[model samples]
Target: MMAKKYSNKINKIRSFALALIFVGFIIMYAGIFFRGNPIVMLIFIILGMLSLVFSMVVYFWIGLLSTRAVVVNCPNCDKPTKILGRVDMCMHCREPLTLDPELEGKEFDEDYNKKSRQTKQT
Candidate 1:
């Protein structure tokens, strides 16, 4: 079996926000089918606009979080990337990264980032 691939948290959140934008537009376009029924069309359009507004909020939130994230060059790819948690995949190469020295050179596991897990280890 192939190992599961992990994505950087920042990239993942951004991707989700971008997808929401597309979904919102698609929903609005679908409203065109109900043009004869003004009420239904208006409802669909309103829902789509809500989705778009929510996406904008998400983007803004992530943007602020990104400014606070740790930036480091990936050892594998030699490119700058942001790390959101203790363990995160590289943005350019998906290589596992860690801020804690104790966890270095070990198998990549998301559980390592959990506070409960670290406290147990200690």
Candidate 2:
């Protein structure tokens, strides 16, 4: 069976924020086509601005969450990385890491972070 790919939570959230910015700009640019209708153009502009504002909020939230995440040096790459949950991939090498000893040698499964899943496994 093929293994599932994983990414650092921080990087994923950062990428998502970047995507929102692009989407917001695209939506705003689309408003140019509706120049004939002031109301329609205004609506599009507002929606685009909302997307940007929400992206900023996401960025801010992620920044705070990142500060609280545990930082550890990846054993494989010897580089520092943050772990958001029980199982997270190394930001630099994509190596799987875990704080729980029980999950140390197990396959990299994101489900290990879930309380219900852990309970079921035990």
TM-scores of all predicted structures: 0.92, 0.94
Clashes of 2: 0
Model 2: pairs clashing at backbone N, Cα or C within 3 Å: none
Please give the TM-score that candidate 2 achieves against the real structure.
0.94
Model 2, C-alpha of 52: deviation from truth (Å)? 0.5
Best by lDDT: 2
Predicted candidate 1 versus true structure: per-residue lDDT over 13-114, tens digit per residue: 999999999999999999999999999999999989998999999999999999999999999999999998789999989999999899898999999889
Candidate 2 lDDT by residue in tens digits, 1-122: 99677899899999999999999999999999999999999999999999999999999999999999999999999999999989999999999999989887788888888899988988
Specify the highest-TM-score model's number.
2
Off by over 4 Å in 2: 1-3
